[model samples]
Every structure is written in structure tokens, then in C-alpha cells.
Target: MGAWSKVRRVFTRDANIVTAEDLLSLAREDRLGGRTVHVTNDSALRHSAVWAALRLRADLVSMMPIDVYRQVQGLQVEVPKPPVLISPGGSEVGIKEWMYSTQFDLDRAGNCFGIITERTGVIGPDGRGLPGRIDLVELGEVTVRAKGPQISKYKICGVDYDPWDVWHERQYTVAGFPLGLSPVAYAAWSIEESLNAQQFARDWFGAGIVPSGTLKNTSKTIDRKNAREAKESFRAAVSNGDVFVHGADWEYKPIQAVAQQAQFVEARQFGMGDIARFFGVPGDLIDAAVSGSSVTYANISQRNLQFLIMHLGPAVGRREDAFSRKLLSNPRYVKLNTDALLRMDPQTRAATIAAQINSRTLTPSEARALEDRPPFTEDQYAEFDRLFGSRSVPTPPPTAPTGATS
Candidate 1:
């Protein structure tokens, strides 16, 4: 048997394989000084900022409707969606869920993988059959082996799969690298800092690492035993939420580290922006305050358009290319309709549509179709004519002036 086969056999037989926690523990021990909260795919998601960034991208991408099209005589025509696009992971998982899962993985890990559960008779240019059903697998469950700039093997859940049988999409790729670089890995330091701050705050409040107040007997000197007793008594009373009444000689001062607490809050805010940058999401989109920057949008549509063009557009295009190549035959391609992202408010939409119709760029029926309304019926046209006059009116020819006749 080959080396990988033997390793696979061993993994199959071994019930207690090395877990992520085990690796994390090892990593923690090897930290080269400073606060190193080793971040993995699972641990990264626990951070609220990371979760929000990933979710925002994944949710938006998944919710955008996907369509298939073909080039016909230099004009693009919409085609019936393939069964694979409708139900990528078979009937159990629809396109929305499949997209969300894959996009989430892609955002975090920079790669998403799936197994080709079924294929159609159509052969792609690569001579491989087009995938009909692709069941996504968790990033942690699959191991990829690469040779130079190309992936050589994929071992998923102790089973070996050929590269042709696997569906892999990648982003943030660099030259000479087979696998995509993970954002979670690159932003580990920032994620770790935020996680540590959270832990520190929890410990500060929950574990009582710092005393809330200091009690001093200003008028008298007390021995160690007396002082200890007094301290215990004060703590016991405070623990029960009772008032500790004492003479004027006993001074009580509350230690409220307002500045220190504010520092933690500031660090968390900065971390949120930093994480947002790593994931290509605008800070304001996820409610992260951007310091020293004032960006205003005329409308929400403009903001969404900026995001689509600057950050999410390339990724969406990459997905379209991948889908087109793997799921469709020659000359047929896939498109993720981004119009949903750039939807305008009612007033803006109406004005824009009116302008388009008046300019003859868009027909009234097409504008109505865009709003999910059917074309105007004969009765509706009659009602419009009754309300106004005939839409078409002829201009009378101008009469030449008698004195300035040509």
C-alpha cells in the first residue's frame, strides 16, 4: 500500500485521533511571549466581530439570486437553471443554504470544499464530468495535499478523494501557493487580542481580580489579625449586598477604574474595525466606528453599490466563473444577480424608473416587471388614457412669418 493509503487505514482504525483542542494546547505552550490566544476556525467564530463580518458577507452573497445564461448570437439570453444550481447538495440542501455554508467557509478560511456526490453526462473542457450534486464538507474535516502550485489530493474524513471528484473554490490566493490564504489565520493576532480583552474583562468582573474598594482605619493602627478580621467582615457584608456601617475613623473609597475600562472598550472597537478590514467588509456596515473617516452615501443603494464594486464584486465574479466552469457546459454561464443588493427606496426607484422610461432606455412594461408587477392590461391603459390624454400627440407645423417668408 502507498504511504497515504497506510495513513488513511491507520486513521480509519484509530478511534481517538488528534483533535483541534490538542493542537491548540500544543500551540499555547509554544507561544513566543506576549498574549497569544491561538485562533482556529471554530475559536475565531466565537469572536463577535469575526462572526458578524463573516455572516454579513455570506448572508448577502447567499441571498442574492443566481441565474444561468447563455451567449446567443452576441446577445446574452437567460436559460433555465440547472438542477444542480437549484439543489446543489441534492434535495436535502437548497441553493441558499449551500451558498451560505460555502460562503461562510470562503470568508473565514479563504477556501471551500465539497464532494461531487453526483454528475451529469456533460463533460467539461477539462474532460471531467460536470457536477450535478455537490455536498459541502466542513473545513476541519478535510485535509488537502498540494504539490507545487496545484492540489494533489484531498482526504476527507479518512477517505481519499481524487482532485477531480472534489469541488474546491479559493480566494486570497498568492502565486506559488496551492491553497488560498485564510483571513482568520492572517487576522489571528487581532482576533487573539480581542479574545484576550474579553477574557480579561470577564475575569476582572467575575473573578474579582481587583477589589472594588479599599477600607482604611485612618485614626487607629490595627495588627494583622485585627485588620484581617475587619477585611473579612467587610467583604462578607458586601457579598450579601448589605451596607457596612462604620465610625468616621474608618474610611471607605471605591476603586472605579473608569479609564481602564474605557481602554478595554476602545481596544474592542478598534479590533472590530480591524477584523472588518481583514474580511473586506466596510466598518459601518457591521456598525464598527471608523476613526478619522467621514463617508456619506446619497442613499443606501449607493452604499451597497460601493460595497459590491469595491469588496464583494470580485469574489462574486470568481464564484460565477467557478460555477460556470464546473456546473454548466460550453457557452453557458452563471450569474449571481446583484440587483437585489442595489435596491433603492420607493421614491428613488420610482424616479429612476420614470427617467429610464422617458429616455426610452427601458420600456414601461419592463419597469413594471422589475417591480415584480405584470404589464399594464387593456383596462389599465384605458384608465390611464381617461385620466390623461393620448400618450402620442402630433406637433403642428410652424407657419412661416409673412414678412420673413423663405
Candidate 2:
């Protein structure tokens, strides 16, 4: 059995799983700037860096088109016009929106939920249901209702759905837990640290660029009413507008403190980097400072390749497997075409395509398709042959070195 299967079995059979009451308590513990870190999708996304990272990843995955293929005699054949492929939900938004929503939820909450509907009168001979329509459910609205280790049912949008009817995609989960652990929840301290820093900066500026200090009235016998008036006047003059002048020893001594003194900027940047790590996005990708690599990157395609392999590969693989298991049967698989992200400069791409065409790994028509161009017509083929025809030439034998052999 696979590792996931083992984990599932252990989780389903474990007796020490948290009860419904505990799960509710854990799930509900979220507040902004509170002692306990709240890591809900809405609250966590308030940070711009986190939102941007999630958006980038979701769009990157969802923008890719999904291809469905069937196995016939041990060969995979592309399935065109499959009901599930065309429209998974029988809605106007189609697959891209569905994928975007699902990926967003998966990235933010570490879980995604979908409802599956089988096609009517389209069942195959093997008694397997034909996939008809699938719909994505908001991750925030779904609640896991479990009895011991096993999940009893899923409550979504005030309706109860059987475990079989709901398709669940989850990320990291601890032992005996039916729900996946969100990155925000796991890294709440880091995210909250960032949020606190942001709030501090806002308050600092809101209090004006002037630091906190005492305002002394050197005038003899100042009344309480006069002191209050002077305080409000000073605040209005300093915070509301620009320059202000005070008469007679009524001076405002400002506290000398800077953000750099406390490394506030550095802390905020570090927090952003931490969030990026949780999302599997490179710090440099989201404009966060890349500490080690300060050199300029000349090869964008190479960087994109590394990102695809190192960062996005696992998430995309999980999505593919989920589609394969739930929407397709054995021997058939689903794939998200990532060639678009691998595109290079025109000249470089042309050279690469030429190499592939020469090696028979890609045809001219296929290369054209990659460029979103039409396939070659017979006339174009004739022209190509005329320009570059097959030919064989005889080579002269090597000559002896001049005046060498005696």
C-alpha cells in the first residue's frame, strides 16, 4: 500500500482522534491582533504578500488546460468532447474557473471540496458511473463532521453531503485528524508577526512622523484648561499639517527613534519570506528579497523550469491524481499542460523546436500548434520539401600530408 493509503487507514481506525467539540473549538479560534492567532482564509489573505503569492500560484495552475485521455490497447488516446472535460459543473464558468477556485482554496486552507455528479444513461459495461458534472464548493463553508476517526458526513452550505458524494483534496494532515492543516494555521505565528508589524507601522504614521514626547509649558502657573488646549493644539499642528512653532519654553522634545533602530523593516521582510516558504513560492518570485542569489537572472526559462519542478510540481501532481481518480477510471489519466510556462524567447524557442523536429520528437505541425498557429497545409509541405530535400553526397578520401610520406 502507498503512504497515503497507510495514513488514511491509520486516521480512519485511530481511536485518539479529536471529537467534534474539540475540532469546533480549534477551527473557531481566529482573531486579528488577538493573543491567539486566527488563520482563516479571509483573515490570512488580508496580508498583501500572502494574497499575491496565493494568487500567483492559483493562476499559474488554473491557467493550464487539462487534457483527458483514455487507454485503448495499452495506448493513451485523447478523449475529445468528454462531458466532464468540457464542463465539469454544467456551468458557464467552465474548467478554468473551477480549477482557479479549487487551487485557491487548496493553497489557503490546505483543503478543497468538490461535488461529483454521474452522467445518466452513460454508464459503461463495467458498472462504473460515467462522470457528468462536477461543482466546486467554497472551502470556508465546508465543515467536517466526524465520529471518532472516521468522518460521518460533510456539512457544506447548510446541506449534508455523503462522504462518497464529496470529493476532498487535502494537504498536510496530522495523525488522527480528518481535516488537513492549513499553512496559515501551522505558520500562524509568523503571519501574525507580520500583521502586527504592519499594524505598528500604520499606527506610527497615523500618530504623525513625530515621535512621542512631552510638551512642557514653561509659562508660570498654567491652568489645567490651558494645558489641555495646548496639547490639542500641538497635536493638531503636528499631525494634521506640517511645520509648527511654539512660543516661550513651551517646547516639544521629540523622542529619537527610527524603524531601522528596531529592525522593523528587516522583520517585516523576514516575515514575508516565511510566508512565501509556506506557500511553496520562491521569495524572489513574489518580490521578496532573495538572500543568497543577488546576481541577475538571464535565463527566465530556466528559472521557470526550476519553479515548476521544485515548487509547483507536487501541487499540480496532486490535482492531476485527484482528477484521475474521481473523474476518470483506471488506465486513464488527466494532465495539466504546462508547456505554456516553458515558453522561451522567440529565437531560442525556434532553435529548440528545430532540434526537437530534427530528432523526430516533435513534428512541424506540432511545433506550430505550440505557437498557436495553424497546421501546415499540403502546399506548405511541398514548399518545405522543395527547400530542404533529402540528398546524399560522396566524400573524397583524406589526402596524405604534403611532403611528409617518402
Best by TM-score, which number?
Answer: 1
Candidate 2: Cα lDDT at 106: 78
> How much does each candidate deviate from the true structure in C-alpha RMSD?
8.5, 8.9
Runs off by more than 4 Å, candidate 2: 1-39, 116-131, 207-211, 215-252, 256-262, 295-298, 372-406
What are the TM-scores, per candidate, against the unseen true structure?
A: 0.78, 0.73
Q: Clashes in model 1: which pairs?
A: none
* TM-score, predicted candidate 2 vs. hidden true structure: 0.73
Choose the strongest candidate by lDDT.
1
lDDT per residue, candidate 2, 156-253, as tens digits?
A: 87787887777688765667666765776555677767776666576566755564677887766678998889878887887754677887868678
Candidate 2 local Cα displacement, residue 281, angstroms:
0.4
